[model samples]
Target: MTHSLRLTHLVVRVAVVALLAITAIGATAALRAEAVVEQVPPGAARAMWVWDTSNPQAVVDLAVARGIGQLYAAVPPNVGSSPQLAQLTQLSTLARQKGLRIDALGGDPGWVDDPTWVVDNWLRPAIATHLFSGVHVDIEPYATPAWQTSRSTVVRKYLSTLDTLVKAAGTVPLEADIPFWLDEVPAGKSTLDREVMRRTKGVTVMAYRNTAAGPDGTIALSAKAVEAGTALGVPVRIGQETDDLGTDPVEVKQTFHGFTVAQMEVQLDQVVAADSSSPSFAGLAIHSAAGYAAMTP
Candidate 1:
């Protein structure tokens, strides 16, 4: 072959290889982004709620046994008190030493009327302790009697309260617990799910269901919430109920009762299958430590 022809051939071959390499790299990056699931900070594989901080050792032991790396421990309304503050700090240190994240948990629909109190009394004190990694609020405005009479106004107030709390939290991450059906509840132009995701750092969806894949199950009901969170870049944790809520109305009772650990694991697997592709899929949270520990399987 002529020298010029040989040089041209070599150049063409090199260019083709480079093009193929670029295409491969692009494809890999796209796949990685698509499969990305947000890992909850402190690397919590499973999280459980703790309603009391009186016995920090007991709570930590139970959490360690169940592979729980996060605790949504309840903070007393008078959290600013010296005794309460000391207890929380000790609990936080113990949990952190075990590589667990502790988030201050507080909520009351009444707080909606005075969100400033929620921030000043609860959030600010929790942050001042410097023990909590984040704050988790379980304010269900719909539980109030006024919700039945004034749905729109109540929901708007709820959204406004969350907005204020988020701002008050400053650099500390704020997470809210929301019902899976929030998508069905309208709050002005947008649904509750959209507004909450837009305001909070993350959300724990109370996707209480016996199963995970059916029409009324956790995965199906949580679809809209996951989608909204994913779009807004907010992490979402699917929460399951393990507590036995006795003799409540059928609808209310559906939030808890009747689930073994094995069954819950199965349901969580389905949730992961359905949502693992989303960047907002954080992980799973059991309703409470005591209840979950009592369950069979």
Candidate 2:
């Protein structure tokens, strides 16, 4: 063969091999992702919020007994401390051994203004300990009185906070807890819920309602979040409130305190059935570990 022809032939062969290698890598990644998804039982992503880390073993035992697959637990802000770090490491190891995913949980309205502080001071240190699989921030900006006075500004700040957190989290997924009413709030040309979901790895919508199937129930309220998440290829976890808020006027609409655990399960079943078509419908997250334990079925 002529020298020119030989050079062209070699180049073409190299290109073909490179393309095949790339294709193989892509296929392998897709299969791995599919396997992970399959491992998660459908309609069985039972999760709960845990605040106390005093007795990690007790928490792990309870989670195992309840068939919980995930726990959003509160890690101490002083994760730099040896004792706090040790506690988290122990808890994380136990939870992992029992086939449970544990995420570092934190939240505050002030976090909107300075999310980097949370990332640098708490998230990074906790993650460095290799104790958390992800970060779950429950920053309810609406809780701040300033939200009423400067609604648009507050909304923008909240979105910026999520952006900052996502960047700082690096490979660690960052999830946010958002209110169900976020769909009703306008942010720029889109809704607040859409903006938040666009930035975070996943979202847990606090669809804190007593009913499940009615127009104003949890399922209906959570529909928008599920739809948005599905469109964005992000997972949406529907959160139900089980804690007793007593007679507090502010928390009147937040819980199913009077309902039995069986009733709550029935509601959750309805929610799962309603959102079953959405690939991003992650599953249900009960309000709290202690509260759920106290619930009478």
List lDDT for all candidates, in order: 0.71, 0.72
Pairs of colliding residues, candidate 2 = none
Report per-prediction Cα RMSD to one decimal. Answer: 16.4, 15.4
Model 2, which residues run further than 4 Å from truth? 1-43, 248-253
lDDT of 2 by residue, 39-120 (tens): 2236446677887665577667656544567888887675878575666778889998977888889889988888778778
Compute the lDDT of residue 266 as modeled in candidate 1: 67
Q: Which lDDT value does model 1 have at 213?
A: 76
Model 1 TM-score on a 0 to 1 scale: 0.80
Residues 194-290 of candidate 1: C-alpha lDDT, one tens digit per residue:
8888887788888887678778888888888889887877878888887667666655435545665556666676777777677777777888765
